[model samples]
Target: MSVILHLFIAILSLIVLLLFDYVRKIQFYKHAAKIPGPKALPIVGNALRFIGKDSSAAHDILLDIAERYASPCRLWLGNKLFVGIYEPEQLKTLLTSPKSMEKASLCSLLRPWLGNSLLIAPVPIWRAHRKLIQPAFNPQTLRTFVHIFDKHSKSLVQKMEEELEGGEFQVGSYMISYSLNVALESTMGISETSDSKMYTRYTECVNRTMELIMVRGLRLWLHPDIIFNLTKMSKEFYKCITWMHTTAHSAYDTVAVSLQYIMLMLASYPDVQEKLYQELKHIYGKVIPENLSVATEDLKKMKYTERVIQESMRLFPTVPFLTRKVVQDLEIGGYTLPQGSTAFISVIKVHRDEKYWPDPLKFDPDRFLPEEVAKRNPNCYMPFSIGPRNCIGSTYAMMEMKTVVAKILLKYVLKKEKIQPILTIKQRVEIVAHPVEPITIEIVKRLPNTFNT
Candidate 1:
């Protein structure tokens, strides 16, 4: 009788707590009625429907709702309501607001891995880090690193040519390797190490860490601490974190890491790669002394390579979505959003929105053709995001991407490898999107003498 009574009391307490939570949510929704959204459940809200869907599908559903309501809309995940702010004007307001309205806890989860890196520090820390690191990516500074980037690109090309006797290879995987290499070398001033144990660990860690963050993002309502203690999932996450931190520290010392994806693409894409190689050969052919100081004039000439990198970013943006929270009762698109609401800016949708880009699905590099881009609105093409909190590493990321791509393309021919169907990468929201699988590609080489001879 005593045991049964205690059980009843515990159950009653849970019921009361759930009821109180429900009433609070109901009150919020009543006030938020002006904000359009699908009906909510008793306690979980739309989280039940959203929990299983990937980011792309969720955005698709949100788009449908936005279309149905004929304006920006709202979604409730548990008690937290997120309003979808789709209009360019509304986005401008949210992004430009002086207050920090865009704080998403998902970013908070990344602190364990990224540390105080510019990726997710508080605005002040973010500002300081951005300032300190800004010089590393200056056009002149980046140009100096061109030789360093080129050296690795050449080595990778040689490795590929030796491995594959010139055949069709999955070019996309190589792009992954190249991108990884660029990130390491450019960001930390490192070189590439062949398929070594440490290199393998770092690559694995990057992916695993990303996967853990995605899981945590999905289960934000259920505190990750509790989940971490109870499952093998947590073990894998911590292991990855350990490997990543150690490898990063090692790279800082050894000055060698892997640049996987970007170099891979350079190797596979013949036309772009050839053009970059010719430019490099022309610039370096006369035996200019290797100087760490690169001039602005050198970068100005690589216009087409810049266009290719920009186009690649457009097609495969690092972050597919951006989110923010409403701290107070706010109005957007004629809807009254309640305090403590969340808002997601669908980047993929915005980029591909037919109204903004004609033939949005097609990969036409010239769409960014100087004259054409001038005609378009800035909000339509924000892969690095925009406004005060925009990616501080924007200039650096672009320069690094262009430089690395330029270096590799200048030397090797990248062939398209047989890629399996693309799986949507579910990783931590960080500097860029990371795939779930290690992108595999066979690298082929074009002998340097052929072009000069």
Candidate 2:
């Protein structure tokens, strides 16, 4: 009876201490509490609402909340507060701010997979690495990748020809393979013949790793390394990390998903594809059988083709969201975002905002024409993000995208698979925005006479 009484008293004391700590932390976010947002529940706060949902669903919920409160809204995940910014003005202030250089704490989930690479590195380390790597993406260096892009793209076309038997097939897998090939060759000089089996294993591992990370992120109980490692999923996760490190670092999902969107958009709109093909034909002046290589000079002249790619990205930005942790207290839109606040920039919402994009859902490539682009806010469309810490490989990625797309367009006329409604592909956010369903398309062999090589 005496031991039981003592144990009860100890438990009561611990509960009291925990409550005091919770209140102290809540006071720390008093400034954020004044900001507009949904009313959070006590203790668990808003986290309980997102406990079982996938990242994509959770992302959609946040987007909806943003719409309800508009930009500069606060979200509470348990006791932690996140500010969601969608307005161009707020985005400009947040993105350009030097103090907001470090990635948010949530990005730590990516550490297991990406390691301490450029994508998730903190500000100081990122700066040093960015300076060292910037030269590799210069115009001269990127020009060398044009040939590699062309080769792999042609290889992609051949693979598609052999694989797609007129019926609808998912282009996502093939695009991933093509992008992986380009990334390996350009970054590590790994040719296709170097280790085909290893490449296959690496791709499989990457897919598994991403799926595991996304699922784990939503489960609060799995946040701790010890608990996560004990699970069966961690076994595969570590295995993937080993394979990834053995080869070069992993490629971003944006590269593959961007290609998927471009293909889907072109297929959905044949008129746009025809115009793009005509521009390509005018540049190449009839596709040569033996010489499918596109020069950098010729690729530069593809204004309309570039516009199509840009518009595709605008409609479906591969990276739908970007986040940053505030290193210093900042003020925006008559509200103070205290230091340690996480800022969530909704790229999807910003790109689709009717204020910046008239008839925002329409796929109009002409929106990218210099005159139209000049009329809009510079911060409105940022598929690759903006400011100093933006993607280092943006220029290289664009050139590669254009090269591969132009090559594919030169050989095939892409048409929608007709089994699904046009533009009905559902999107899911798993690190990068990807279609929840298979983006199926039918490819007709065009320029058969030029294919005798």
Candidate 3:
């Protein structure tokens, strides 16, 4: 009788503790009850809704939720609360806040791949590193990179001349190679001729790891480190990360993806391409200069080219979303987002919001003109993001893009090629948004006397 009484008492104590914890969680939920969101179930919350879904599908669901609830809505991933903000007005409050500078918890998933680099470092470390690295992208430094950019772009043009024989070819593969070469040479100080095979393998691994991480992020079962490590995916992820560390200090996945989109958009819109070509011709006339070295002043003069790049990014941002964690209780648009909550900024939806962008689907480079840009909220257009944490290399990226695009346009005219699917491209979201199918385009050599330099 004594033993039975002791066992019963222990079981009852455990039950009471669990009930107390459950009550605490319920109280926490009530804090955000006023905020709009999908109906969340007990224990699992919204986890089941995203289980087994790919990143692309998950992205669509997020956009749908944003549309339904509008800005400053609540989201539950398991027990954690995420406040989704899509409107520029609400975004300005979150993005510009110094307290909300830290990356969201979801970014911790990239630890194995990116390590504690500036992209995902903690607040103090990130600030220090940002200060140190800011000079690397200064105007003087970026001007030097223009030479490197031109040299690699010329190599890409030469390769295209040799390989593109009138038929259609996948442009993405070539663009990736070109961008990788530029990234390695300009940033890592690694020349394309040195350790070419290692660079190729490392890039392949980085790409694969990004895809796996995206899949793992959606599946709640893989959240715990112990469970994630026990799987084959984790094994491969670590292996790639190890190889990447040995080869390069940084990754240019964003630059590669951006180039792919630029090429695709140029091919899809012939009139846009023609206008861009005309701009390039005005800069460098009929006789193409064999030794083409674009100065910073020259790049500044290419206003139309810059506008085209901006417009392309508006339609297809390399990073479709950006996330930050709230370090303190904050009120925005009438709702209180408690401390420790994650805030997601949907760059894609905000860029396409009809309220700010009239005919949002149309490809119009003029939207980036000074007067037009001034008409809307500054935060509305954030391809490289805005505020203090914005991309440090935005200028370098723009210069590199301009040089590469100019070189290609000077040599060849890109035409849309027909495949079975007819290039009805859908974006696949990994670390960056990528086209579901390879983008292939037909290239024709430009007439010799088209422009006079």
Candidate 4:
């Protein structure tokens, strides 16, 4: 008799919650109706657009919606409202607001792997953890890691020797390995060689686990904890995680993704590459790139190299989208985003917006020239994002990418394998935005002493 009474009470509570949810959604639908978006079907809303798409296709679908609609437009994702903020003013309002400081529920998917890390922690927890992590990324501390960057980069170049005359080969593997080696050795003090059989297994497992996490993120139906646990994907996901060390770092994907893009861009634009090589020549005079050991002080001297890296990031931001949950009625892009709707900021759209950038598709590194940069709105270019919650590792990432790029350019001539415009390249945005096809470049060793300043 007691069990029957408990069941009746539970069913009553569930019905009450469902009724409340239905009423709550009316306000979202009302506002979303006023905003511009493709007409959504009942119940599922616009989820049909994402139903059969792969991650890259799903990414393109989102990009299409952002491109077709103006900044203040809305999309009904299931019963949820997602406001796309692409205009500069909208970005300023959403990014700077304390009310919008909370991450969207999608970020919670990372919690199973990352726990309540800085990436998905609540505002209060994030603030505290960010403060704690700041010292580790300080300029002084980052300078010390220049050696780590320098060491692994040289190893990276060596790993590509088989491909020296081996024709066009994928450089992403080399770059990812280099990124992992440097990050592990420096942060976790893992000196296990990235090339060793055991370390390779660990790296492979980590890669597979990340890929599964991305797949789950794309397939929205698997988002519920209970439902996800019932599937084979969940089993595979846990198996990979079990194989990985508890400390497998996930933050370095952006670094690896960005580095690969920069290498390809350099390969495509030789004149730009030549200019960068000249800067390296000026700074590291008589020091052959093959044997070059970049000092803490030398990092600052690569001004042109920094610009090249900056331009590459603008064209191909590793993490192109940023999402936050609206905590209250928020005014942005001339629209009122109701509380509980998600604010989806497309940094890529802003980066490619022709208003701020002339010849937006061109690969001109000089666009980042100080004089040119000063003329535009500061928020116009946010490869590492902007406002209070911007990426903390921006400085570290820049230094690391610059170190690797400079080292490689110093030794080998990276001839472009695919002669195509920057945007013409096929791309995928799952865990990170990267080319769908492997970025291939011919590796011809630059004759020693040819460009010694």
lDDT of each: 0.59, 0.81, 0.81, 0.81
The digit string of per-residue lDDT tens for model 3 on 1-453 reads 699999999989977875786587564556578788888886567878788777777878888888888788888876678889988878888888887889988889998777778878988989999999988888887788888888888888887886566677877767777888888788778776545576569668877888888888777678789999999999999898888888776767788888887887787787888888888777776656456666677788899999999998998899988899988877888887777789988999998888999988887889999999999898899999888888888988999899888888878888775523212456778878887777778788877656421
* Candidate 4 Cα misplacement greater than 4 A, ranges: 1-22, 196-207, 451-453
Q: Score candidate 1 by lDDT.
A: 0.59
Which stretches of candidate 1 lie above 4 Å from their native place? 1-15, 18-28, 52-71, 135-144, 170-192, 224-227, 249-296, 417-432, 435-453
- The candidate with the higher TM-score, 1 or 3, is 3
By summed lDDT, which 10 consecutive residues of candidate 3 come out lowest? 417-426
Better of 1 and 3 by lDDT: 3
How good is model 3 by TM-score? Answer: 0.92
RMSD of each: 5.3, 3.1, 3.8, 4.3
Candidate 3 deviant stretches above 4 angstroms: 1-27, 194-200, 418-424, 451-453
Q: Against the true structure, whose lDDT is highest? A: 3
What does candidate 2's lDDT look like per residue over 189-240, in tens digits? Answer: 8786535576577767776777777787667678888999899988878888
TM-score of each candidate structure, all chains considered together? 0.77, 0.92, 0.92, 0.92
lDDT, candidate 1, 89-109, per-residue tens: 677767776443546656777
Q: For model 4, how does the per-residue alpha-carbon lDDT over 1-48 read when each residue is reduced to its tens digit?
A: 699999999989977876788786877656667778788886567878
What lDDT would candidate 3 get against the real structure? 0.81
TM-score of candidate 1 on Cα atoms, chains taken together = 0.77
